[model samples]
Target: MHRRTFLQSAAAVSGLLPLAARPSFAGLYQAAAVATGDLDAVRGDGRPVTLPASAIKDLAASLRGPVLLASSPGYETARRVLNPSIDRRPALIVQPTGTADVRRAVSFASAHGLLLAVKCGGHSFSGMSTCDKGMQIDLSNMRGVRVDPKARRAYVEGGTLLGLVDHEAAAHGMVTPLGTVSHTGVGGLTTGGGFGRLARKFGLAVDNVVGVDVVTADGSVRRGDPTENPDLYWGVRGGGGNFGIVTNFEFQLHPFSGTVTGGEVVFPIDRARDLLRVYAEWSQKAPDEVYVDFVMSQPPGGKGGIALLHVCYCGDNADRDLAVLRTLGTPMANTIKVQRYVDFQKSGDYTDARTMGEYMKSGFTTGISEKLISGIIDGFEPHPARSTGVFTQHSGGAIGRPPVGTCAFPHRHAQHALMAAVSWKVGDDGAPHMAWAKKYWATIEPLTSGFYINEVNDESRAVLNANYRENFPRMVAVKKQYDPTNLFRLNANVQPA
Candidate 1:
């Protein structure tokens, strides 16, 4: 039986059917005390989970940056990550000023038997960057970007957001390919093989990685690149933060002049069949300079989904290239035009002003077959909520040519990736939204070849093994060498052998 079907059947048999059937409450966030477990929150190995007040004070004194406890001024804001679904309450939020501060935080967590999580842009979909009654080493204060125009390179601090990198790279008429959102942290994105508008032409963010300054589980500072500590370099390219806390990244930049002809064409649901058919045929042979995606979303105040064709062309003939995409179908709206790359990047950020609950599951596809297109259309029509939909991120071009086994990111040959996102208000019963996402995922999962570790929520050993595929053993070796005790078990963990 299909994996999702079996899981759903099992849940039904166990009285968990219709996930939205749980008792409902009306509130913006999870109950406050629920997040703050009783003073004793630590589990496993029977160690004392509670730390003395004096020890927290001492640790605060050691940090050059501020240490925020639950009572501090910015404690609430500091502890919150991007996803509202993750309402973890860490005991202390440590804002590290530099590599030294990061090292100190790691050492303190290890010595005191504290659960440690590393927070960069706080965009982790799995909420692995924060833990209950632990220390969240926030890199928000370390954002800094230095550009070497002559060498066509850039060095970005770990906590730096992709927006900052975009602005700085634009100053030099260059760019280091990153994700769609501007606020996403550079550390997590690059480490997980970042993909964005320029990726089809310039390659993934990891493909541009030249080096990294990292603080490992042992609190030792080290540098990894193509030469020195090559294995470490390989692991960090696609290995989530299981090995260490990356302090900074050196990237090779590409010239783009900060302008791209890109935008979206939206058509009513009636045109989906024709739109998807054309999109699948043309996108397969699209040039490296062109990036396009097929999206199905609920129109504002509308009953069903509208088909959207998103376009970005880096070549000179923007008008000529985009005109071909406009032929996808009769459109309800067409906004494709030449615009600043930075502005285009921000346009893709989540539209919700308040933090809303989010759940996502993504996988890679080798081609957009007719069955896949039909499944996508079927999945979006009866969306559980207006905030939920299925979309494809076109992937090819430079992404397909990376030297095999050069780095840990091995989904090089995938033609595109599909991500199913479900969103709802915090107070609502999340069962329906989660169930909707799972059912949609099940519809398309069989069409996919592999998964994108960054977009998935499943942490089961079986899922992790499948996500990494042939690269799993190598990642395990690296995990054993750097973190035998699983000090960084908060991510798509690659436990030591």
Candidate 2:
């Protein structure tokens, strides 16, 4: 049977269907939970079975953390993840206080044929971390990060978020290649070869990944890194979560913890044409210590604005980084100042926790021509009267090239990772933003190197092929070794070997 069809049937039979069918599964799961004397089964809506005292004792002995059944008060809180879009009511949400808890949860889920979801920062835009009516291995409480000042490496738990990583590393005057959004999860991002402001100078988030200890699908613990389990190590570097549940990551750190000079500069809508043109030109030859990014959004009036850019320099001279920006040209607003790296990351902070009915697209650019520029501009003009602006970033530095087949992230030599985001507030103007961006992208067809894997869209099937490119086959091989059944199948997926 097709995997999805089999999965759906299994879920229905196991009494773990989506919320729409949650009622039906609740009974079957409850019975299993009772019979096994373990928290193995759960209804789609998360109701637990009434177990006898003997069963409770057995379940408690097997758990590393509190084994929360659906009726428990903590069940509601334990069941939640970061993204609002994920409304999954798992049969059980196991907040594993430690590694043992995680293992037990994994074991139970596997034995019972339950769907599983792994959540760290809960910021996944694609909702891959949510299991509608199965098991959840939530690593929220496993927060721990220890940095080695001498070795310049950090031991970070799977639950750590980018913002926390930045804050802790800054305390030691050190840093690592992370993600653009501070709220992004370290585990998912690292596994997928994440990029950040430091990418041009250092590399991708996964490039700094020295080692990882994961709990595989079958409940076996394995260490993944270059020296041991080399294939699995490379697979996780950018392979997404096809292997297993990662518990910790050891990363290489650099002297970027202290304050540096950086911030955003907003340009008038009228200057977007010229500004983007200049940005495209300057980025090609920009230095290692400097990074440039652009954000174009639909603002009030008929005009869309440009976030001129943000630059971060790890050098001792803040003036040199400032000069890089000045050398580019004068800006309407340069918030660039002597500030910590964390401060720079927060400059573009969007406080609205509210996820919107948005149509956001992400992709990489090896080259952007005048024709492409016009198309992007045309897409922005009539978006949500006040929606996200364009975001442009430099690429291709130390992080750009690894063995091409080393990981799933393929755009090794690509130049820029740009995003075309069109979102709106409730009852706000949103149609124009979606229409404009989609049409503009259509106009720029054939210019983009396949869509970057992270920016997957229904029409962007070709993009995934490009993102993995030469490494696609290797990824399949590694995937098969760890997850032959593709239990963790989701995201811009690579079929298991």
Candidate 3:
């Protein structure tokens, strides 16, 4: 079989395929290692837990979707997530096709004392979506997208990917605020406050969320919106998937021109110092409709890395804006042009290529100082791996304008959200790359105010606190109210008080 064909087939059975889309996996797993991790420990803080073989068999028989045991034919493939760094072995993998199926899985896991992990697009950076010797609720087959043009809303299944949302919304001349990656799970991203090229104008993916259909820890289906189950709604906005399994989402859509002007301009490393200094100045003065980011990464087939200034303008005066942007610095290449919004959306999604060991660390700051810029450039030049680099979201427009304490995300006042990401081959030692990223982040740590929950790699409880701030208390209250047992503790969890 052709190499690409093998990858496509592998991605399908592995439940890693993107929606409305293609795939990615290079040097992933040539051989699946059998897991021998302990299965009898308690998953949450409440009590000791255990799941017997007969109970697992009964749960398997009860599911409409296929139940794959560890030794089953497709079990190995079904268990892989997007990040190669995470290789967990769930005792039983249950694929759920609908909300009813999801409720059954949730109920079974809760009753049987089985640790539960949820998988949508399988894109969790921390691998919190799956666990060892536990039970996995796989929603890969539950993807469905419906757009109501007249109502200006789109109802997306929790299993849907950003690509499908973009495709459906574009057909109706509308768009939903989401992350840049086309294949990322819409459920995880939105539940944790998603943002993308359009976010500067539309706020966050959570901000556009109108309603949600969730299955709580008790197996009861509940709906949350501004007026109904308001506290639950607030918690879900940026609280990760701690409260329940979000089976469906209803998002308010924005009217779009269906066309955007954006692309990348690459400059040599020597010019990064000057380019970055100007980028800091431009980020503060740019219009809400103009979204751009400075990304440092190894140039394709090149020796050293280059700084790329990527621009996505969804507003008018593109010609004028492009002219002014070009003046930022001399470029080695420019790809900016008018294109369909969906096309532009697909341009920079690194996940479209292949899966690899990846780590992402984030920090949010209200301002970017010269020292921070220098630190970023220093981090870029000495990357330990080819894919190790850094970037920041110039997010002060719609993102910062959201009222404080409106939702679980507390970094709304931040003008920039910095991220240091590193990727490596499956078997390569990640220590050096991680160390480089840490060293890079250390130089700017004093300037950081908070962190983005979605991009976090540090699983420590203290980092989780920084993501929620004063809102952690309210989230704990809601978690206690709905998930008092902390059944949904797989994500960036807030232990029920």
User: Clashing pairs in model 2?
Assistant: 15-25, 42-91, 173-257, 174-257, 295-390, 296-389, 296-390, 297-389, 383-433, 451-463
Residue-wise lDDT of candidate 1 within 1-497, one digit each (tens)? 01111122122112221212212222211222223333443521325587665566666667677776675555676677777678888877778889998998888777776778888877777788888888788888899999999999899999998999999999989988898878788898888888888898999999999999989988898899989888999999988787899998999998877888878788776777778788887778888888988776552234545667888888997766666764554577788888999998887554322245667788898888999988877666453332655677889889999775888998987888887776655577777868877887788889998877676587478888768878888999999998887778778888897
Clashing pairs in 3: 24-354, 25-354, 25-355
Give per-model CA RMSD. Answer: 7.9, 9.0, 6.1
Model 2 lDDT tens row, 359-476 = 5566678867787788777655543243445666678767666767656667787788766655444365556756766775665556766555544545444555456788877888
- Per-model TM-score, in order, reads 0.89, 0.82, 0.89
> On a 0 to 100 scale, what is the lDDT of residue 278 in model 3?
75
What is the C-alpha lDDT profile of model 3 across 1-497, one tens digit per residue?
A: 01111122223223343423221121111111222332353454435676655555555556656666675555676678777788888877777778988998899878866678888887777888878877788788789999999999999999998999999999988998898867779998998888788899999998999999999999999999989999999999999889999999999998998998888788876777787787888888888998878776552223555676788899889877656665765678889888998887766554343345667778787888887887776656443333656677778899988787888877788887777776665677877867776777777777788787776667588778756988989999999999988889888888887
Superior by TM-score: candidate 1 or candidate 2: 1
Worst 10 residues of 1 by lDDT: 1-10
